[model samples]
Target: MGGDHGLAVTIPAAVNLLRTHSHVFVHLVGQQVAIEQSLSRYRNLDPTRFAVVHANDVVTMDDPPAQALRGKKDSSMRVAINLVKEGVAQACVSAGNTGALMAIARFVLKTLPGIDRPAIATAMPTMHHGMSTVLDLGANVDCTAEHLLQFASMGSALVSALQGKMNPAVGLLNIGEEIIKGNDTVKQAAELLRQSNLNFYGNVEGNDIYKGTVDVVVCDGFVGNIALKASEGVAQLMSGTIRDEFQRSWFSRLCAVLAYPILRRVKRRLDHRRYNGASLLGLRGVVIKSHGSADAFAFECALVRAHDAVQNGLLEKITQAMVPLSAEADAA
Candidate 1:
C-alpha cells in the first residue's frame, strides 16, 4: 500500500478482512500519514493482529531497477522485501511496480536452491473446462532449454498441489503437438520433458490452451505472457457480450432473471481478474504479482494464494523432488 495511489480503498478492505479473520496478521507499509490513516481506520483492531511499519520508499513503474533499489532504500517495496528476509514477515505481497517487485523479490527472497531464475506461475480458466496453471508468465522471456524444463517441473508440482494429485499431467506449450516443432529452446525442452519422471504430455498449441487438454502448460515468458493477456482479453469480451444480451428488452430481461444466478456463477468462474496473482515459483518464499488495476478483492485473493502456497510447502516439495532427480540424471 505504498505507491502514489492512496490506500483509501485497500486499507479499509484489508482492515475489514482482518476483523473477520483475527488469526491473520496485517502489516502496513507506507508513509506515516498513510500508515497511520490505515491503523486509525482499524483502531479497534487487536494490537497483536495488526501492525504498521513506516516505509521510506515507494517504487514507481517508470523507475529502473538500479534506481528503485539504490534510490529508494526506504521505499515500501524494498522495506517489504526486507521484512521477508529478516523473518519479520512470512511473505510480502505488492500491487505496485512489476519490474520493481521482481527486482526486490530477487534481491531479498533469493532464488530457490538450484534454480537460476524464478518464473511466474498463475492459474487461468480453461475454455474446455476447469482451470489450468501456466508458468514463466513474463518473469523470463528468454530462457535456456534447462530453464524451460525447470518451469515445467515447477508448474507441474504446483498444479499437482492445487489439484490434489500426485501428477496433474503436464503439457509443454509449443507451436505444435509434434515434439520436433518449435524453436531450438522448446525442442530441447521437449526432449528433456520426455525424460522427466513427472507426467509430461508432450507439446500443446495456443488453440489447445483452453481446451483443458492438459493440466499444466509450460512456455517461455515472452509467449506465455502474450497468451495469458490474449486469453484474458477474450474472456472480457465474452463477459461483455453476455451482459449486453441479458440487458435487452422485457422478455430478454425476464430471461436474464431466469438465467441470472447461473450467468453470475459463470461470470465469476470465468473472471480472469479473480485469479490475477501469479506466484513467482523457484523463489525462497511465495511472492505473487497481481494486475496493476487489481481491486481490493483481487488483492485479497492474492493474499489467499500466498497463504496457500506457503501452507502447501510448494517450494519444499519441488526442491525435494528436483534436487534428487538432478542427482539421478547426473549419475546416469
Candidate 2:
C-alpha cells in the first residue's frame, strides 16, 4: 500500500518469499480487503503462512515526515513498525517514504542503548566480487566525530553478522589516504577510530570503495548519499554507452549477439536488484527500507535482507559490538 506499484509489487514479492523460506510468516499490513484480493491471485499458497493486518491509511511519497509521524498514525508504514515494537514481528520492511519511515522508526523504536542516532547501512558491491558495508546513506546529513564512530561500530557488526568476518576492517572515507587530508570532524573521527577496539584501517579515497580497501566505509549522510547516486549514475551511463555502441551497425549487432552470454553473466554479477535492502541500523528493533520503485524481484531481495538480519542475530551483534564504546564513554 505504500510503494510506487503498491499491492502489485509487494504482494507478489511476499508470495515468492514464503515459497522459498519455510520459516517465514508475513503480515500484509494494508487495507484487509485489498490485500486479501491481491493474495488470492496466487494459487496453492498456505493460508497459515500469512495474514492480513488491516491499516486504515497510507503515507504518500510526498507527505512530510512530521505529517506521517503524527497525522497518519494508522498508515500502513506506522502499523507495520508497530508490529515490530509489539513483538508480533521480528522485523519491519517498507518500500515507502524514506524520511517518514526513519522518523517514525526512530520515534517508536528509539535508538539502541549506546547509539545516538540510527544510520542506514547497506552492502555495496565491490570489485573483488564481494561486498563492503557502508553507512549513514541519507539518515544523518550532519554528524559529529562520535556519530561517525558509532556508524563504524554498527557497520562492523552488520558485516560480521552477515558475511561471517569476525574483525572487518573499517575505513574512514576521505579526499585522500593521508591522515591530514580531511576536515576537523573527519580528522577527529579518525583519531577516535584509532583508539577504539574496532579494526580501523585509517583513511581511504572514494575510488578505494570499489577496490575493496576495507570491509566497512563510514561517512556522513551528505557525502554517502552523493557517492551512492554518483555510482548509480556511472553504472547506468556505462551500460547505456555499451548498448548504444553495439547497436550502431550490423557488424556490431552480430558481435553483440555472439557476446550475449558473457554480457549476461557480467550483468547478473553487478545486478543492483540483489542488493536492494538498506538496514536502519542503531534502532532498537530491526527495520529495513526498500527502494520505492522496486519491482517484485527487488522487493523480494529486500525481504531476504530482513530475513537474514533476523536469522543472524544482527541486533545482538550490534549491541555486543558497542560495549567497548560505551565503556570508553563512561571512563571519559
Candidate 3:
C-alpha cells in the first residue's frame, strides 16, 4: 500500500513466492478490497497459504517519519511489523518510505541488546564476481566508535548466516588504508575492530569495495549512503551510455547484435534489482526495506531476501554474536 505501484507489484511477487515455496506463508496487510481484487486476477493462486489483514490507513512516501509514527497506527507497514512482533510472521518486507519504516520498526521491535541504533545492511556487487555486505546505509547519519564496532559484528554475522562465509573478513571503510587517514571516530573504530575476535582486514579505501577486499565493510550512515548512491549512479550512467552508443548508427546496431548475449550477461551482473532488500540490522525482528520505486521483480527479490534470512536464522546468529559484546559493555 505504500510503494509506487502498491499491490500491483506486491501481490504478484507474493503469488510468485507462494507458488515457488510451499512452506512459506504470506500475510498480505492492506485494504481488504484491494488485496482481494489483486488476488482475484490470479486463478491458480493457493488461497490456503495467503491471508489478507485489513489496514485502513497508509503511510505515504511524502509523509514525515514522525507523523507516520505518531499517527497511521493501522497502516499496512505497522500491521506487518506487528505480525513479526506477535510471532505470526518471521519477517516483514515493505517498499515504502525508508524513514517511516525505520522509525516505526525501532519503536515497535526495539534495538538488539548492545546496539544503540539499527544499521541498514545491503549487498553491493563487486568486481570479484561476488557481493560485499555494507552496513549503516542511511540508517544512522552519525555514529560512535561503539556503533561502528557493532555494525562490524552484525555485518559479519549476517554474511556468515546468509553467504555461508564463516568468519568472513571485515573492513572498516576509511579514506585510506593507512591507520591515520580517517577522522577520530573511524580510527577509534578501527582499533576496536582489530581488538575484537572478528576477522578484521584493517582500513579499506573506497576503491577496495569493488575489489571485494573484504566480505563486510562497515561505515557510518552518512558515508555508506553516499557510496551506495554514487555506485548506483555510475552503474546507470554506464548502462545508458552503452545503450545510446549502440543505437547511434547501423554499424553499432550490428555490433550490438553480435554482443547481445555478452551485454545481457553484463546487465544481469549489475542489475540493482537482484540486490534489492536492504536489511535493517540490529533490530529484534527481521525487516527488509525494498526500494520505494521497485517493480514487481525487484520487490520479489526483497521477499526472497526476507525468506532467506528467516530460514537461515539470521536473528539467532546476530543475537549469539552480540552476547560477548553485551557482556563487555556491562563489564565496562
Candidate 4:
C-alpha cells in the first residue's frame, strides 16, 4: 500500500506470482478491505495460498525515516518486516520509501553478526550477456575501508549463492585500474580484499561495469548511487531518442516497421523491470527493495528475487562466509 501505485500494482503482481509459482505463499500486509477489493478482481485466487494481514497506516514516500519509525508502528512496511523477524515469513519485499524501509529493517531485523552496516546490492545487465552484482547502492553514504571490505565479502557470497558462481571475481570500483589511483579508503580496502580468500581482481574503472570485468563490484554508497542513476539516465535518453526518431516521419515509420523485431530484442535486453529488486545484504533476514515507481511487472520481479533468495539460503551462505573473516579480523 505504500508504493506509488499502492495496491493497484502490488495486488496484481501478488496474484500473478501465486498463479505461476505454486510453491510460493503470499502474505499481503496492508488494509484488509483494500486488499480484498483488489483480490476480488481476480476470481481464481486461492484463499489458502494468499492471506492479508491488516495494517492501519502507511509509510508514505515523503515520510522521514525517523518519523516513519516512531509514528507508524502499525504500518504495512513495519508489519511486513515484523513477519520476517518472527519467522512467519522468510523474506520481505517493499516498494515503499527506501529510507523508511532501511531504518525500520535495521531496527527490527538488525544487521548480521559481523556486518557493521547493510549494503544495497542489485544486478546490472552487462555487455557479456551476463549480470554484475554492484553493492552499496545508496545504503551507507560514508564508509570506512573496513566497511568496503565487508561489502566485497557480502557481495561475493551473494553472487555465489544467486548466480551459481564459485569464487566469483570481485573488483573494487575506482577512478583508474592502477593500484595507486584510488583514495585512502579504496586503496586500503583493495589491500584487505587481496589479502582475503576472495578472488580479488584488483581495481576496475566505471566502464568496467558494462564490460562485465568482474562478477561483483564494490564501492561506497555515495559513488555507487551516482553511477547507478547516471546509467539509468543514459538508458532513458537513448530509448527516448530511438522513439522520437522512429516517429519523426513517414519514412521513419516504415523503417520502424522493418526494424521492429530488432528493436524489440533491444528493449527486452534493457528492460529495467527484469532487474527490479535490490537486495539489502548483510541483514539477518532477506529484504528486497523494489523501485518505488515500479509497475506490476517490476514488482513481480522483486517478489521472484525474494523467493530465490530464500530458496537459495542466502542468509546462511553469508553467515558461513563471514565466520572465517570475523575470526581473522579478531586475530589481527
Candidate 5:
C-alpha cells in the first residue's frame, strides 16, 4: 500500500486480511527508510501471515517512471515486481508512484501475448445505466488507434469475467455519438472496432457514459482521465450542494436529521475508497494500482483486490485469451 497518511490504519487491516491466508509473506518494497519504519511499526502484526522483505529505494510521484526504472537498480517498485518474477510473492500492490508502478510491471512482468502496453483499467458507476469499466485512464495520453482497439478488447473481457455478462456492449468515447464523429483516432478506432471479433456498440458521447450505453468505454488516457476526474468532481459537487441546501433552513435542517441515514448511504455509494483499486491489464502478472492519496482503509481495500486477483488467476486467464488474439505478434 502507498505509505501515505493512514498507513497505521492500512497496516492493521492488511495484517488481519493476510492472517487468514497461508504463507503470505510481504515484500514491503519502498524507499529504504519508509519500508524499515513501516515494518518496525507493525512488528506485532501477524507473524504467520507476513514476513517483511525490505526495499530501500522507491521512485516518487514527481519522477518520470520510465527513466527512474532504468536509473535505479533496487527501486522499491522493481524490487517488488522482481520478487513476484522470482516466485517470492504471488502478487504486489502499491499506492506510491503510479508511473513507476506501470514501468516496473512492464519491465519485470512484461506484457502478455497480445498486449503492446499494459493499460490501467477501472470500473466506475455511470449515469445512463449500470456501472461500466474504463481503460487506459492515464496509461497513455497519446495513443494509436490500435491502442484504443486493444483497450476495448481487454476491457470487455475483464468486464465479462467480473460482471458475468456475455458479449457486453462496448463503446468508443467520442464527442458525438454519430458514426462519423470524433477525431482521426476515434473515427479510425470506430472503424476497426466494427471489424473486430469483439462486441462493438459504436460510438458514445461523454454525456452518455452514465446512461449505461456500453459495458466498457475505450479511450486514450487523456480523454479517459478527464472523463474520470469530471465524474468524480460532479459527484462531489452535487453532494456538497445538497448538504449546504439542507443546512440553510430550519425545516431543511430538521429534514436532514431525518434523512441522515439516506445521506450516509449516498455518501457510501460515492465513496471512492470502495472503488479505490484498478487492475493493470495485459501484464504477464497481475498488478493492482491504488489511489495515490489512499489511506490505510484504502490500502486495505487494495490488498483485498490483489488477493482476489491472485486467487482467481487473472493474469493466467488474460494470457490464455490474449495468446489466441495476439498470435501474430508472438509469431512476428
Candidate 6:
C-alpha cells in the first residue's frame, strides 16, 4: 500500500508472479480487507501460495524518512521489513518512498559487518546486449574513498551472484579512463581498488557504461543518480521521437508500417520495465526497491529480481566476498 497505485499495481503483479513461479510464496503486507478485495478480482489463484500480513498505516510518498522510521512503525513498509528481520520472509520488496525504505531498512535490518553504509545497486542494459551493475545510485551523496571501495566489493559480489560472473570486472567511474584525470578522493579510491583482491578494471568514463566495458561500475551517489536519470531520459527521447516522426505524414507512416517489426524489437529491448528493481546492497537481509511509478509488468520484474537474489544466496555471497576487505582493514 505504498506505491503510486498501491494495491492496484502490487496485487496484480503478485498474481502474475504466482502463475509463473509455482514454488514462490507471497506475503501481502497491507490492509487485510483491501488486500483480500483486490486478490478476489483474479480467477483461479492458489490460496496457499500467498497470505496477507495486515499493516495498519502507510508511508506516503511525501512522508519524511524520519517520520516513516519513528512515527509510523505499523506502516506497510515497516511491517514488511519486520517480516524479513523476523525470518518470516527471506526478502522484502517495496515500491514505497525510496528515502523511507532505505532509512527503515537500515534501521531495522542493520548493515552487514564491515559495511559502513548500504549502497543502491541496479543492473542496466548495455550496448553489447549484456547488463552492467552500477552502485551508489542515490544512497550516499557524499562518500569517502573507503566507501567507494566498499561499493566495488559489494557490487562485484552482486554481479557474481545474479549474473553468474564468478569474477566480475570492477571499474571506478571517473571523468576519463586515465588514472590521473580525477580528484584526490577518486585517485585515492583508484589506488585502494588497485590494491584490493577484486578484479579491478581501472577507471571508466560515462560512455563506457553503455559500452559494457566492465561488469560493475562504482561511483558516488551524486554521479550515479545523474547517470541513471540521463540514460532513462535518452531512452524515452529516442522512442518518443521515433513515434512522432512516424506519425508526422503519410510517407513517414508508410515507412513506419514497413519498419514495424524492427521498431517493435527496439522498443522491447529498451523497455525500462525490464530493469525496474534496484537492490539495496550491504544490508544483512535481501531488500529490493522498485520504482514507485511501476506498472504490473515492471513490478513483476522486481519480484523476479528478489527471487533470483534469494535463489543465488546474495547475502551469503556478499558476506564471503567482504572477508578479504575485512582482512585488509585488520592488517592496516
Q: Write down the lDDT that model 4 would get.
A: 0.93
lDDT by residue (228-261, candidate 6, tens digit) is 9998888788878989999999999999999999
lDDT of each: 0.78, 0.94, 0.92, 0.93, 0.76, 0.93
TM-score of each: 0.90, 0.98, 0.98, 0.98, 0.87, 0.98
Candidate 4: residue 58 Cα off by (Å): 0.4
Number of the candidate with higher lDDT, 3 or 4: 4
Best by lDDT: 2
Residue-level lDDT of model 1, residues 264-290, one tens digit each, is 888787776678678878877777776
Query: lDDT score, residue 101, model 6?
Result: 96
> Where is model 3 poorest over a 10-residue stretch in terms of lDDT?
41-50
Q: List the residue pairs that clash in candidate 3.
A: none
- Arranged by lDDT with the best first, the candidates are 2, 6, 4, 3, 1, 5
3 or 5, greater by TM-score: 3
TM-score of 2: 0.98
- In TM-score terms, candidate 5 sits at 0.87
The candidate 2 region of ten consecutive residues with least summed lDDT is 122-131
What's model 2's overall lDDT? 0.94
> How well is each residue in 1-332 modelled by candidate 3, as lDDT tens digits?
87899999999998998988889999999999989998898997777898999999899999999999999999999999999999999999999999999999999999987788899999988984898999989989989999999999999989988898899999999988998899999999999888888899999988888889999999999999999899888878988899999999999999999999999998899788998999999899999999988999999999999999989989899988888888878888
Q: lDDT by residue for model 2 over 1-332, one digit each (tens)? A: 87899899999999999999999999999999999889888899998989899999999999999999999989999999999999999999999999999999999999998999999988888996988888889999999999999999999999888888999999999998888899999999999999999999999988878888999999999999999999999999999999999999999999999999999999998998898999999998999998999999999999999999999999999999999999999999
Per-candidate alpha-carbon RMSD to the true structure: 2.5, 1.0, 1.0, 0.8, 3.1, 1.0
